[model samples]
Target: MTETDTLRERVAVELTRARERTLTLADAVDDHDLVRQHSPLMSPLVWDVAHVGNQEELWLVRDVGRREPVRADIDTMYDAFQHPRADRPALPLLDPTEARAYIRTVRDKALDVLGAEPLAGRRLTTDGFVFGLIVQHEQQHDETMLATHQLRTGPAVLDAPPPPAPDVPVDDRAEVVVPAGAFTMGTSVEPWALDNERPGHTVDLPAYAIDAVPVTNRRYAEFVADGGYDEPRWWTADGWAHRREAGLTMPMHWHGDGTATRFGRRTDLPPDEPVLHVCWYEAAAFAAWAGRRLPTEAEWEKAARWDPATGRSRRYPWGDDDPTARHANLGQRHLRPARVGAYPLGVSPLGVHQLVGDVWEWTATEFTGYPGFTVFPYREYSEVFFDRGYRVLRGGSFGTDPVACRGTFRNWDWPVRRQIFAGFRTARDVA
Candidate 1:
């Protein structure tokens, strides 16, 4: 009824949604495949699923004194922060059925307890905060899983790769014009934004135009067809070296008879599907080939945040509502990149399609701190990858949790390694 009640209800709903997502993701992967070491960045799928459940229980129940049910060995098996991956493979893992059941039990217990009492006035302890962090953390891993699977299995799961755009379209044709103004950027106000998005600050921008849609598979195909991969002129030194080392000739989930195909499915190229599995180098090369460049992080936020009438920050591209299937491709059963132009309503203020959820858009800026940036108590958040080699990525992907797709959310990865749900869109400085 009241605002406090509404907030509490939202939190409860979020917890339910989080549980549902974890269960669905866990169920999607074959039990036998859960143990495979997909990549160094990825944990075994089983471990991640149990870890998510354990984290929720540890946070809301054990730490909060409701002290509801949890697996006895959870501390030993799923305590990821304390025990890293090197230690995971050797642990006595629960059987897939048991693990799923345990996860459901913990989730139900957490919901029953939290639902009874509103989370409104509850003061979260450090451990409790860690639980919240794990939720987002696990959601990120889920996205990675989808990406890794696509990379390994090809576009059999994707709807299909779209045909390349016709001549990159006119540069200004579908641009969402953002007016000049100052707006807050970052996570200062939100209680749960990642450290990188935190200490929100105001940013000033001159007028700018951003693409109304993410770069399509067809558009990127054009780049590759134009020798973007072979052209040293299109690549940075680091990018070229990465290309040479990885032997990357196309986007990660592409294959066909000398043409690009989406992962996991045989279908006609859709031309409207957003590109997926592109590394920073590929994204950059495609941009260069098209005579445009990836949007800077600030430019992206500006275009997504600008308000036409009042010029205020829009909480999300589609407004403050949480993501839904109608809004974006996230939380779907297929867990693959969707057609690019599918969610017209999800466009950012500046007309950037799929700004919130589809595939993360690679930005030109290096991952770095804003003014007054400080690390969280744990060192692994932002400080782990401040090196110049990493690039910033924005917008959450189809595999991403809705909560993790907040406009200010910041994700980073090495420019060369495109393993985890990485993709890009292009932008150019308006004349």
Candidate 2:
């Protein structure tokens, strides 16, 4: 197929997938829940629904088409940065029906712009980047809405089939050595890569050995059982303060005796599931308890991208291809992480599993600009949070859609955050 045809097909697939997922997530609950603020941290579902379309219209139609906004009056109502999530419910947001109609109307115009548009010769559309960006933006909001669903206290409003059972038991001792060298640490050519992930640079990382898979609940439980929470040495000053203030004994949504714990309203899971909902502090403390440190961002990316045989970087841990169901547990296809070591097909060249999905893996790096980072479209998307005591998270979560999850896609949250889908694997200097 022609390259432009390929781009058009991709645009169509991504747009449809993003919209459908958003609709499905919003439809899972009743109309009242859709417009209600389930949690103070998240915008109302109805707000997210309309904001998704508003963003698409702003970028795809207005920016690409060079046309004035069709609904300029409602722009402020949907501007996320203008209103905190807690106060968004007070705005005059469109109802679910109106939201659906608004998104459909915007989408109809966007599809028309997609065909007549050239693939390049512009800043944002340098290889249809804006289209990809819009798709990613819509999918990211869908993920946020999914978080709201999880926080909503009710019987399960969403359901999905469990991931395929692992063919082998997980080995907690599995760590792979990524050889010492200068490896490409970020994306240079990924058309849809965000501004923070741009301008790939060579990182001279010393040799390190990292966990082949993420740290699992079975292992984290051992730390908790050993007075890991009560002890202060393993935690930082800030972490210890937050720990005591919040009275956190275990990962959020967890409750049990030392023998077993359950997540939210789910059934009791086996010990092999990757630990989730733990903040950076908890993950770091657990790593310290195990006599390991969390991988630096450079080390994590090297393990995920380097191919020792060819001495080149792959777009993803497995290869330079778009993800598929056979490769990773992503796109809300499953509501929870698969058992560790399940998606062997998604393994990196160095044999790292669960690097792309199942959960967002925390890294021991602060959120900051790259060497040549410059504002694009606006600064609110990533730059504002660069200094708000946020740390980096790699990989995507099961709640993340494929359009939003890429090898270089970066997620950040405060170290004290626990409601989000976050997890981690540990690394150590090569001995």
Candidate 3:
């Protein structure tokens, strides 16, 4: 097939895959739950479902295809910036049944546009970037919905087999030494790289050692037992304030015992699985208690992507190839993180393991644009979030889709927010 035809097919598959995930999550819950706000941090499940379709229609059917607006009256209702997530349920949202139909209609029109619209010419059309943006956006919302499921208090609704055990026994306490050097930090040539990750830049750093795997539940429990939370010295002023206000003694969903809740069911926390639901403040405090610091954003990327032998950065920890089941736990394949060294094949050249998927690892760096950043299509996507209010989290979680997560992919949130599946690994300066 011609490159155009190939691109169109790929886009179609991605759109389908994303929609399937969105629907599956929506179906898992009843209408009452779908329209219900499970957590203040997340929008109602139905709102997320319809919002993805609205975005698809706005970007693809309206902007790219030059078609009349589909459901323009509800545009304000679905406009994320217009209405905060807390107020979405109060709006006249399309019910679950209507939402499914709306997305189906929008996807049909979007696919039609894909078949006819030339894949090249304008910057947005070039490399089918807009379609990619939509796919990523939908996948991100699906993850958000999954987080809502985790937060909802009720009988278990979602289920998935545990992640595969480690291929080879791994030393959970081991660290990988990344030597001081310069490496390309962002993607300029990657066809669908988002604007925030654009304009590849070089970052230099001194030698440091990062955890070989994420800090596991076992290690974190040690911190908790040692009064890591009670001790104010480990926490920064802001973190200490938030910790006290939020009463964050342990990871979210965790109980006083060694068990934690997952998908509305309480189970023994896996000793080796990376700790989840940790906010930036908790991660920073854990690092301080451990006598190590969270890896800077550059440090995380370099450890995950930079290949010292080749003097180049790879698209993922393993290589430029897309992820498969053997790579890392992603795409909601497993609802929770894998054991620390589960994906031996997914390890980076420097032996850093599970960097791409498992948990969104909190970094020491604040969210900001790279050198020579430029807004594309719209500024709301990334630029609006560029202020220093957010902290950067590298690596995508098990809930992340391959389309949305990459070595350079950036995820950020308020430092005090802990509802999402976030975790951390520690790093230290060379002695």
RMSD of 2: 1.7
Task: Name the regions of candidate 3 deviating beyond 4 angstroms.
Answer: none
Scored by lDDT, the top model is 3
User: After aligning candidate 3 to the native by TM-score, how far in Å is the CA of 390 from where it should be?
Assistant: 0.3
Candidate 3 lDDT (Cα, whole model)? 0.93
| Clash tally for model 2 | 0
Compared to the true structure, candidate 3 yields what TM-score?
0.99
TM-score ranking from best candidate downward: 3, 2, 1
Candidate 2 residues 94-163, lDDT tens each? 9999998999999998998998898788988867888888888988888888888878876777778898
Measured on C-alpha atoms, candidate 1 has an lDDT of: 0.69
Q: Judged by TM-score, which candidate is best?
A: 3
Report lDDT (CA) for all predictions.
0.69, 0.86, 0.93
True-vs-predicted CA distance for residue 180, candidate 1, Å: 4.2
Between the candidate structures 1 and 3, which one is better when assessed by lDDT?
3
Q: Please, what are the lDDT tens digits per residue for candidate 1 over residues 253-279?
A: 566443443345544545556777788
Q: List the residue pairs that clash in candidate 2.
A: none
Tens digits of per-residue lDDT, candidate 3, 1-431, equal 99999999999999999999999999998899999998877899999999999999999999999998778888989999999988888899999999989989998899999999988889999999999999999999999999999999888988899999986778889999999999999999998889999889999999999999999999999999999999999999999999999888899999979999999899999899899998899999999999999999999999999998899999999999999999999999988999988998999999999998989999988898899999997989889988768999989999999999988899999998889889999999996
Cα error of candidate 3 at position 61, Å: 0.3
Q: CA RMSD for every model?
A: 4.4, 1.7, 0.8
